[model samples]
Structures are given as structure tokens and as C-alpha cells.
Target: MSSQKEKTSPFMAKAIEAALSAKSITSPNPWVGALLEHQGQIINVSSTKKYGAAHAEAQTLQGKHLPEGTLYTTLEPCVAFEGKRTEPCTQIIIKSGIKKVVIGIEDPDPRVKGRGIIQLREAGIEVQIGDGADEITRLLRPYIKHRQTGLPYVIAKFAASIDGKIATKTGASQWITGEKARDTAHHQRAWVDGILIGSGTAISDDPSLTARPKNLSPEQFTQPLRIVLDGSGKLPVNSKILQPTGTIIATSPKSEKNWQDSLTEQGAQIIICEPSQNGSGINLEQLLQVLGSRSILSLWVEGGSQILGSFFSQNLIDELWAFIAPIIIGGDGLSAISTTGTSTLAEVPHLREIVIEKLEQDFLIRGFTGNWAP
Candidate 1:
């Protein structure tokens, strides 16, 4: 039984894996549940549901005799009480005769930041942390981000034709990629905390912004933050996006009224960009910095041609996921990007590296920076 498990404190690792599976349980509070075992015997198990629900530690201590100095749990013990309950998780662990604590992911909420570990250490509890919690932690990031940033991971999404046109000559471009590619796009949304698009695209297309093809589980799509980039501030106040999860307006500093407080009142976050070039949209680098400072660890730039081109020219892309539609449109409309300025393969910014994956039709090209264009 001992050799059957794998990777760092097998009991804790397995418990973390089990706890991480609750990523979809967002509504009714984050359900952080775990099981404890020592010397191949089930000692106890527990979970946290809603605010007043029995704490994971409380349930863990249910009807059991624990061995002294035995390690317990992957979630930090709670200290702060919400509503009418005041049972701190620290006191419970100490009372249970459990001499050690093992946490999976650090509590991301700043209010309770580091308090769990501090209390456990002060009480002379031997603390051990699980190693493989990152994967599960990342999966739970969607829920954590909502509590902290008031906004989700703002990923920009777009699809362009061979020549970079989002639409054709008459401007009627519906389905450009195959079913497989389109399906993949929706799945990609699961990784992002939110979806962002320009007001122009929103007004022009009126996309629902929900994960498409309907592959995601119900819990996955229910909480993504939706954003709209409207530099001129032309979006309707009662827009559809504003009705549901509401819309985050990416406005410039010029729109002083378009700051965070106002947007927050309207269930939105006002993102201030660094002004658009030629009085158009804001610079992508500055835009990303603003989002990154807000703790948007990862982002996806949905393209419309000019937007993708700007990032390409500036070489700000850390990773790229390009979907080549099976069929190519030889049109005089828009191109993926105009590739402005003068340059050949030699003149453009040289990519240090790239990995190419051949899909059913198009190629998925991922590129890296800092290298010369040789």
C-alpha cells in the first residue's frame, strides 16, 4: 500500500488531488474537502460548504481517535468567522490532538493571507505542504480570482481570414474555421477567467461571449467575467453583457468618470489603458501591464487584425495559439495583420523559438521572443 502511491507525501498528494476536483463547486461557497490517512488506515475526512456549514476541520474531527503527531489536511485552517459562526480552524486542529498541519494551496484571499500558517506554527504544530497542488490550484484559480480582483482573467478572442479579414468583401464572414477548430476555441475559454472584446466587435457581432460548442460542464461557464473595450465609450449602458455578468469597460484615463468606483457600482471594473495610438485604441503592452498589476497572471489576445499586429510588431507575445482554418479566402478584405512598415523575413523582429503542431487543417504555431531574425 505504501509503494502504490506516488509523488511527495502520498497521503497529502492524494488528498490535494481529491480536493482540487472541487473546482466546479463555486456556488454555495468553495467546497474544500479532504481525507486523511496514516499508516494505510482511514482516520477521518471533512469538507467546507457555504459560510455557516460545518468547517472541513470540524467534520475531520468527527467521531475519531487520531494518533498523536499525525499530519492532517490540505486546506489552511480558518480563523475568521463569517455571519454568526466564530470557530477558528486553528483552534480545532490544536484541540484534535493532531500535532501537524499539511496545506495544499495557500489561501489566495488577502484578508486571511498567511494567517493560517502563522497560527499553526505559533501553536507548535509541525506543518508540511503538498507539492503537486499547483495543477489543482490553477484549476481553482477562477473562483479565487473572482473574490480578489472583482474581474476574471481578461482574455481577448478573435479569428481572422487568410488575408486578415474578420469579414469578407461584403462583410459577411460567419464560420471560417472547421468544427474541430471552433470546438477547440471554446475549450480554451475554460483556462481563462474572463473574455474581453472591443465594443466595435460587440456592437458589430453581438457575441454572447459564453464558451461555445457547449462542451464545458455547467459550472465552468457560469462565472467567467465578460469585458468590452470601448475607447470612445460608445457601448450602451444597458447592454446585454451589462445585464448578466455585466461588462468591464476598457476606457482611457480621459474618461475620468469611467474609473473603478463607478464601474464597480454598475457591477463592472473600469480598466484604464495607456491611450490609443493615432487616437484609436490603447497600446497592448501598457494594457497588459495594467491587467497584470491587477493580478491577471495569464491572458489570451483574441485577434481582429490590427490588435494582433500590434502585439506582433512590439513582440509582446509570450506564447501564441494560432488556428489555421481549413479553407483560405483569397480576398481583398482584411488580412490577419497588414504587416505595416518595410521588412522581409530578415527585417521583422526575430523570434527566438517556436513549436509547430499540425492540426487537421491549420497549423498551431507557438513562438518565443528575444531571438534574432536569421
Candidate 2:
């Protein structure tokens, strides 16, 4: 039989994969996975589903006749929750007679920060922590930041030609990446609390901004909140964003009341925000604060250059995901970001812990920002 620590590596990978399987519906709650082993054989494998559904541990215990020997979880089992929609996961594990618990990472919720582990240990069950700590921490970065800072974790998604152009001189940027990369971008929409874009993208693209994929059914799809940062309240009345229930149109405090009233009548939440320090756009930090107050845990930004540039100039981006197509568009094409305040080589921004993957004809690059580019 493998020791608990020895099984951590493989178990962690399995658990992460399980977590990803539920990427579409797990929001406001961090994705979790659990594996149960009896003797030397695996008994159960599960991951969290929709919010308020059975959590990872509870799902693993379901239909198992309460049989368990050891449990491995990507996150600590939740000790308690405020609502009546679900029971405490810690109590469920204890009642199942699980002899041991191996946790990949601690729960970041201030309410359950290590409380679950403490509860299990006090029940005379052996508990271990720090298995696959680095990977698990990285996985839960958004959840951690949300709990600690009361802000949505920002992920900026960009797609550009091999030469770093996002669009042509005329701003025509359709079908830059292949089908596979586009599919992945749609998946990104399914995982986030909301999608944000500037009025420029919204007006020019007139995008529906919904998570509608060719292969998925409408009934099974989840649509993120469609957020448009319209400084001048210039959003078209017939725009598709206004058709969604969670549509938010943020404009500067100086916006006209008639425009506000008109949008409100069209099922849009009108948010008045302070203008940016540069006086040309809405304050990025203030907008994020508004989003955090609404309990939006993660925000995905799909841009048309200016929006991406604003976030970059303010140093507000937390993670970045970019898809680079195989072909170049030249300097005559539009750059992915403009006027980012990088004058010399020393000031360019650098990404830390970068990971790259080839997706069909495009390359996917993911990383965290270390600092603003010099």
C-alpha cells in the first residue's frame, strides 16, 4: 500500500482534473474534488457541481453506503455554511467513518480557515495538509484573493496574430484564431462570474457576450453577467447585452439622467462611477470595487486594445490568458495594447510562472503578472 504522502502527487493531479470537469457551473464556491480509498483500492471520485449542490466530499459519499477508509480532497472539507441549502461537509465526512483526510490546500474562506481540519482532528481522525501545495494554491488564487480583498479576480484574455497585432488598421479582427482557440475562449466565459469589455468592443463588435457554444445546449448553458464600461452612456439601445438579466452599464458620474433612465427601462443596471485619473475613462479600481460588492468572484476581460491598455496602465490585472495565431499581421495592424506607458526596455511588464500550450493552430499562454513592463 502506498503511504499517504506518496499518493499525494497522483491524487492531486486527479483531483485537479476533477475540479476542471465542473468548471462551467462552480461559481461563488471554489471548485473542489475528493477521492475515497478503502484498503488499497479506490472507492469513489467526485467534484463539486453547481453552487448549492452536493459539495465534493458529500458527492463522494453519495451512494457509497457510508464506506470509507481515507479521503483526499483538493480543498479542506467545509466545516459549515450560513445557508440551509447544504449541510456541513465536515460532519458528513465524520459520520462516514473516514479514518483519514489528506488535504491539498486549506480553505480560504475566513469562516472555515483551518476549522475543518481542526474539527476532524478533534474527532480523532488523522489529518494531513500541504499535499500538492503549490499547484493547489495556484488553482485557488482567485478564491483566495476574493475572500481577502473583496475584489473580483481579474483575468485578461487576448488573442493576437503572431506579430502581436490584435486587428488590422481598420480594426477588423474576426477569426484571428482557429476554431479550437475560439472554443477555449467560450469556455473561459462559462467559468467566470462576468465578462467585461469597453464600449469600443461592445459597439464595434455588437457581441452577445453569452456563453453560447455550438456543441452545448441552451438549457445547460450558463451566461456570465454582461458588463459594458460605457463612459458616455453611448451603448446602443438595441445592443444584445441589454437582453441579459445581469447586464450592467457603467458610466461616469457626469452621464445624462435620460440615458440612465432609458437603459434602466431596458433591463440594465445603471452604475455611476468616478472617472479615471486620466479623465478619459471609468476608474478601473472603482469599477472592480463595485463588482466585488455584488459578490462577483472572477471577472474575465475580452478586449479591443483600449480596455486592456487601461487595466494594464493601472496595474489591475491579476492573470493573463492570450491566444497567438500562427500568422503575422504586421505593424499596420492594431497592437494588442496601446500607450501602456512603457518607454524603455527596463519598464516592460513581465509575467511570472508562465505556462504555454499549443491548441490546434494557436498557442495559449497563461501567466501571472510580476510587475508593470518597463
Candidate 3:
């Protein structure tokens, strides 16, 4: 009985919930949701399931006859057959007897951008755009970013002390946050397409970096692609990362081929990138482009500070999620980012906090790159 633009609209809330269900499953294509209200009653609610499967609107039409009603979709339905998988969703909606359509946002992708809305309008269907835009945009941020710039959406994650240190000066960093925070981090890892860590982290922590947390069954979890930024291809042969299926070790061209070849034989994909501008590290932009070409839509970087600093320096981080433990280890510990040439307060990196919550003993702070606050 209500349009989708209202802040507290039930239709918008249900659509968002439906979209969230597709997390960890849909990549390359943003998660989408469709809800149909027929005769003042909710008839169908559907979400995009997989990459090549039926889209939300098409799924909603499954086994149901056309009925006069209003349709709500998190994104504008596609009108053109531009994708690799399914047919246009606008045709399905047009074939149905839906009287009105409310959309969250125009597709950031150029192919179906506003043409879907135009097609619906031309077909004598009432169309309302930009309903629940903020929530839907946040939900589709990774896809939107990838469509705009041919690179994966990057999120930098870290767990640090209250004084902003990831580890002590001796590099003894472990158990900074509680179990709940660690579980939360694991869940975050399960949501992204890839997980990245620096060689320093690989050597220091010797972590598996898989999404299998504690009692969670392997069938229930989706392990992200493991990526290591080892500048010289120095990942040890005994490292736990080699045990995984989709493991990539990115290094500079100057790295030794002997160890690289050995690791390649051990199930690691070696990506030899260009040297950095300073010639001390691998080029970060080039690494991102390589991952982008491989269809990595969203990436999370859990770091040992230096790799996180490189991404920060390049302004490549789209979001930052940190768990701040209420402990002080002020004895020359490693700072979150290794001092990025900010001399004055005006030059400090600014971030907008989107979520700050107390998860047991630690505080989880999630923010974006810009200064805008919610």
C-alpha cells in the first residue's frame, strides 16, 4: 500500500533483507531483490542467487501467473541483453501485469544504466526511481566501484590496540581482540571475493587465512581467494597458504625464479608485477588490475601494516574496518599505517565512521574513505 521512498517503508526493508541473502554468492553482478505487492498483499519476494542464474525480477515470476500489482526492485531491471548469462529482466516485468515499479537506484553499470527505466516508462508502466537509494547503494558499492573503475573494490581491515598499534615493537601480535571480534572478522572474510595479506603478515603470523572459523562446517563456508603480496616471492615452502586451492603470490619482477617456481609447483599462482615507483615494492595498482581482470569484484586486505600503508598511500582503500581492543601496548609498537608523509594535522587521512559497536570487550569501528558521516 506504500511507495518505496519512505524511510521506514516495509517494502524497502524486505527488499534489503532479500538482497543480503545473496551475499558471498553473487560476484560480478550486484545482489538484487524484487518484491511484488498484488492486491494490497505481498505475493513474492526473490533475490539473485548466483552469477549466471535468473535475476531477482525473473526469479520472482517463477510459477506465478501475471497479476496487477506494484513491483519493487533494489536496482533497475535490465532492459538489454548485454550480460553473459540471463536474458533481459525488463522483458519479464513488461510481460507481467505489474502496474507500477519502484527502484532503489539506476544501475551504475553503463549498459543498463537508465535504459531499463526508459523501457518501463515507454511501456506505459509507472516508474519511481531512487527509492531507498542510500541503503541499496551501500549494498552494491563493490559492484558499482568495479563498474566505474576496472578494479576490485578494496577494504582494509585491521585489529589494533586502543593506542593504534597492531603489534609490539618485537612483532608479537596475536589475540588483540576477543573471540567475538575474531568471529566477526571471519564472517567479514566470508563476504568478500578475495583476501589479501602482506608477506610480513604471512611470515609473522603463518596464518591459513581461510574462512573456516572454529566449528563452522566447510560446506557452509565460502573461502575467499588467498592473495599474498610477497615482494620477492619469499613465501616459505612450508607456509600454510600453499595448502589452499586458490592461492596467489604476487611479487616483483626482480624476485628469484627458483623459489617462485618451487612455490608454483606447490599450487600457488605466481603473479610477477612491475616494481613500485620507489623500486622497493611491487606496484599496487598493477596488482589490483590483475585481480580485476580475474573477476575479483571485492577484496579485503588484512595486513601487517606495510601492505595496508601502500594501499593507503595510493588512496585505493574504499573502506576500513578495525577492531579496537581496550588495551595499551605503547612500547614502540607498529602503527596502523607506517607514517604516510603527513606532517601537519591538515594532511591527516580522513575517514567517515559508518559503524562503531561494542562487541564484547572490543569495539568494532567501520568507516569509509571520505569525511562524510552518517
Which candidate number has the best TM-score?
Answer: 3
Candidate 3 or 2, higher TM-score? 3
Residue pairs in candidate 3 whose N, alpha carbon or C atoms collide under 3 angstroms = none
Candidate ordering by TM-score (highest first) = 3, 2, 1
Model 3, 358: alpha-carbon shift in Å? 0.7
Position 334, candidate 1: lDDT: 56
- Go through the candidates in order and give the clash count of each: 9, 6, 0
Q: Over the stretch 1-374, how does candidate 1's per-residue lDDT look in tens digits? A: 01122244666655555454443332324446656665676576555553455666667776655745354555566776455364777777777667766776566655565788788888888876644455335445444544455433333344555444656665455677666766777766544545566666566656666665455676543444566776656665555666564566787766656444555676766777877666667655566556655545445566556666666666555445666665656666656654475656677654334666665665555554441110
Model 2, CA-based lDDT: 0.82
TM-score of each: 0.62, 0.92, 0.93
Error of 1 at 127 (Å): 1.7
Which portions of model 3 show Cα errors greater than 4 Å? 1-8, 213-221, 371-374
**Cα deviation of 352 in candidate 2 (Å)?**
1.6
Which tens-of-lDDT digit does each residue in 1-374 have in candidate 2? 11134334676677777876766677788888888877767788899988888999898887665344778898988977576478889999888877788888778788898899999999988999887767666667777788878898899998999998998887888889998899888877877888999999888878888875667665444678889999887888888878865599989987789988888988899888999988987988999999998878889999878999988877788889999999889968978876646679897888887999899989999999853220
Q: State the TM-score for model 3.
A: 0.93
Give me the runs in candidate 1 sitting further than 4 Å from their true place.
1-13, 24-33, 41-88, 105-115, 133-173, 180-184, 187-192, 212-221, 234-245, 252-274, 282-301, 308-321, 330-374
